[model samples]
Target chain A: MRIAYIKNKLLTIDESFVFRVKYQTNNSILSTIESEIDTVLSVEHSEVLGALRNNDLENEAIYIFREVAAQFERPVLLFSGGKDSITLVRLAQKAFFPAKIPFPLLHIDTGHNFPETIAFRDKLVKELGVELIVRNVQDSIDQGKVVEESGKYASRNTLQTTTLLDAIEEFKFDACIGGARRDEEKARAKERVFSVRDDFGQWDEKNQRPEVFDMLNGQIELGQNVRVFPISNWTELDVWSYIQKENIEIPSIYFAHKRKIFLRDGFIWSAEDDVVFRAEDEVVEERMVRFRTVGDMSCTAAVLSEADTIEKVVGEIRESKISERGARIDDKRSEAAMEKRKQQGYF
Target chain B: MEVLKIATAGSVDDGKSTLIGRLLYDTKSLTDDKLEAIEKTSKQKGYDYLDFSLVTDGLVAEREQGITIDVAHIYFSTPNKSYIIADTPGHVEYTRNMVTGASTSQAAIILIDARKGVIEQTNRHFFINNLLRIKDVIVAVNKMDLVDFSEARYQEIKSDFEELMGKRDYQDQKITFIPVSALKGDNVVNRSENMTWYKGQTLLEHFEALDKEDVYNVGTPRFPVQYVIRPKTEEFHDFRGFAGKVYGGELSVGDEVVVLPSMTKSRIKEIYFYDKKYQTATRRSSVTITLEDEVNVSRGDMLVKVGDLPTVNKEFTATISWMDSQNLNLGNKYVLQHGVNKVLAKVENIHHKIEPDYSGVDESVNSLAMNDIALVTFRLNKPIFYDTFKEHRTNGSFILIDNQTNNTAGVGFIE
Candidate 1:
């Protein structure tokens, strides 16, 4: 099908361009023949007829990105070097094709991230020609803003909130776009697409603003900002499928590789990093495993898999019986772990 | 694969959660660890059967209280389509939450306990679904096993629901009646041998056989420009495109379009989706379009076909659903958001409060409190181009944000 502007009117033509000829001829028989031909052509290409197809998730994300750009003066993307955030980066790129991504990526590094993830993050930023802003939880701890947790289950994951809030204040970002999906955790399921945060960066779960239809209310006070999750409607499989469809580059840890690991609480702990605390009795061994979720080395666990390629990884996720957040040790702490963290502005 | 969003509504103990869990379980969408957790929790609680509510009730308070407090999104996909079910709390107090869940959904499932038949809660659920113009509604008469799987009882409830359907304003809605026991695994994903007298599609079969294209492909094309994409780079110095998602219908290149608020006429020069350009833009697809001439187009401005212009006015009547704790009285000001456009608006008059249970309207009501639905008139500071809610879902609906707290106070559907 083809559309053209002729005589100041929109006209659609099929493969034969019979409509144009029929219009020129002004014959009733020719018009009937043209209609018949159009019907046949439409039926033949019915499967691929629609202009949208099944790209609702991507389209919604792109629309949210544009809304953030239009509504807020200064907006920044919260990049965690994870698959969800990486998908957000690509969506932002698609939102404005010829134009560069309007906002810079804000990475609140826990200082316990994998070296491979950091390298991947830097490379992605350089290739996209977008600015990268890094803030460290250690800096916040050194500044006496937040205290580091001690003992066995200590993770810098919660401490990163302080650094993130500080960076938001420093940059005065009115909107912080994150790649949090609703299907990840229970508390996240109740999140709105355009979530509002107060001056203290607190999320009011019970008294959330009602978001109706596609109209997003981004109205906020001077000190307050909105945490926009474009992919809130997307699930884990959707992200993997989108990544596979786009052929986007990701960290090597996502694929199966030989890594030194130890088992703790039925989870495979990466022994390659000193950030993960292991008891003396916990013997290290080599295993063919891959990371299902990318978080701080202390929290994220590896699943036993041989899915070495994107297609294989997507297939593994499709067939696997474990939820994505099941691999994240933070959620296993309590039933309300995600909700409590979210109320404290932990994105 | 296509994603179908569904909202489930039922009062407490109606087995709504179990029905959802059954759908997930039968489809093999629930992961092993999640199922194990549910099983462990169920066993610890010393229940004879697995409490499927544990799968959706995520909050600690909810678990302790044994009730859903808010809407919880549960995802599961079959080979044909991906499904996102908004598990809304079925309570008299959380009517606003139910509406919130149904607003974005294309379909809804109203669970009716077979023993109780169609109660007042069922009336409210059906009324809300009609108000939201949800296309597909499945009235699942659950707990059929408890009622001995009697086809007579199912027919009785179906007729009761059909009587309530007469009170609905929107007659175009399609409501299907199904008999199923959410807990007994009967007529949910598989046909029930006990209810041999009944012959109908199972819950999963009904969903699979739905015409997905007819769900959201109606109404006139309405494109509300979200943002203006301007690439002032060295290569493309003067590229300015209007970016937004197309709602209702398709828009093609060379369409004589008019920019709203400005009423400036222009033709669509190009329709670009990311790096590729298309001759036509389909409904629900987000694309950037460049006009033939450089018009003063900005965010919140709408691009529509010249012949199909919406009502441009400053004052209008709407059916408002109040959501905030504070009451909405006459003369109260709010930031009215219509699509991407924002304007200050004040309540001009309070018409009447419409009861959700198909009861008559109350005219003596002067103010609307929480969970109240009423017809109200609003005078906008600036004129907005809008259509009736029934005519254009996206163009006609709006949200009222409180000026002081910035909380979404009410949602209005234009009359």
Candidate 2:
């Protein structure tokens, strides 16, 4: 029990102290002293209750970022200009403050991203004074490394994995720090903080090194890379709370605005842009919408919301009935869509 | 809000996944889309009841096999606090998965099938929880509907578990028992009216009543330097900060500190969480510190209070949990990573292998195979500051990286 002092004179005891005395067979002396300290105890109890809690998750993430810096030869932060990645950048900054972030940033562009997201990406990198490496899925397609899909429900989401692999090989990066939270998808729920990838960038779910306590093992062989998710334990609300608390800047597309979108299979697809495939019968209509998650325009869905501010967006997320990934069209492809993609080295 | 991480362990047929799914469903943590998917799959599977395992069995292979293959983390929050549950497998890769899951958890839930009573698998679950030194243990006697929710059956299992508890070396563990029907959703989140005699708090109530401080072990402060932040810029040209996380206890400015490996003494000039300077750095907080005197402190060097020092030694004995397929033999070298410090370690001797069922220790062990837990001595190339696992968990534990494979082959809890 913590002994709380009042004005450095009075000694205060909480309810647990009294309960312990009462449970004793004979404690007449203790009871007498408890009565004198009862009033002071109540005052201290409220103070303890109202104490500002420390952000342990933030501390943990900073530790992980430091480990990646110290353990790997070349580490890069995989930025998607999304809220989670934005939070990761702030954490990285906090990890090595008073000094520039040691690593660069990598963005695997699917070439179908929101223009606002692309704009935000460039601004954040410049503000941080960090190098940004952008690789396009179109480049992979043009080089015949990956084939583009062409169907009503086709998306370039799966094609980013090839480009990401090419970039990793090109840079010879030993570690890729990503913002893949466990709360986003089920396959991610089983992910390790320091997930090891084979030469082909495949994740062996069956055989994974057991991580115990704060000791994260980052040792890996040559030609193998580790995918480090520092915020693997954070949830969607935690991210929003962090953004609101830290006052981090994000892309404007996250807020609610009037946009031309079409309805298909109970999903709202952006129609103002020609990036997404639209059928002849699929009609376009304007709706006040915002994206819960940012990805390829063809794969990302928007919800009917009026949250134009960060605070309002947080409230909307708190009261939301649907999961954040519900807006992700790629996950709806199959029950094992994420697992299959992850095995193929999807960030 | 405080976050309480829990690890749940059960045999293949003990309804472990069902309990987690039920807990999420009853608490309304499962979103509408997730519920719909579960409903759709349950209907297609032609089951009268919902296949709760579908909510946690994320992999297609796991779904096809109807078992958990890895530890899947699940998150839920109430107004008071937040919870992170590590749902791990028990049958296939028991030790590796169970130890991995329980390592970071402050509490654990060991599920027992009411019909099957106390089994060997139950002993393994209790053993790992004890080995990992989990502070709180909840013995959930599940499938109460099948046992008629009988008090006699519950007490019988509790008594059996108590016998196993008596065999454990670490006796400070707090244990609680709850009778639940995970499939029927009784006594998991809500009280069970079927068993009116049982007056203990429900599983959810147990979590709600727990204080965060009680779950965490308080010990001496040990700061292992992770990085050194030096701007070398004109504005703060002479700024030198030792960046690290404070473990076990708090460190305040002006406190006398000693740098490890080279016992140079210095006082804390400032504690910076970020930009703002704090008078004190709380436990588990990642903060950068500027010393009053320039000390040769770098990554892998620890900073401790002048009077409170850890054992700086070149060799020690530890209880090892082997995770690799190859056997751990005498003279086998590994990269021993303790906190941020990495040193080359060679296995000196395999003392004995302890049985997970609390049967006894076998002193005749020559080599440690996969999933083997044994007492072994390791000699390090250089000195490492450590404490007994019982004294300070973070400072006392270490991981062994296989030199050839470069894999985390085993974990050690210093004795």
Worst 10-residue lDDT window for candidate 2 chain B reads B271-280
List model 2 lDDT by residue over B1-415, tens digit each. 3688999999999999999999999999999999999999999999999888988898888998888988899999866567899998888456878888999999999999999989989988888898889999999999999988899999999998888888887899999999999999889999998999899999999988887666889999999999899978788799999999999998888899999989999999888776556667878889899999978888999999999999999999999899899889988899999999999999999999986665889998778888889999999999999999999989989999898887888999999
What share of the reference contacts survives in each candidate? 0.65, 0.57
For model 1, residues B7-113, the per-residue Cα lDDT tens digits are 99999999998998898888888888888888988999999898888888877778889999888899887766778998898898888999899998999999999
What DockQ was computed for model 1? 0.34
- Candidate 1 clashing pairs, residues 3+ apart or interchain: A321-B32
Compute each candidate's TM-score over C-alphas.
0.92, 0.93
Could you say which candidate leads in DockQ?
A: 1
Q: Which stretches of candidate 2 lie over 4 Å from their true place?
A: A1-53
Give the top-scoring candidate (lDDT): 2
DockQ of each: 0.34, 0.33
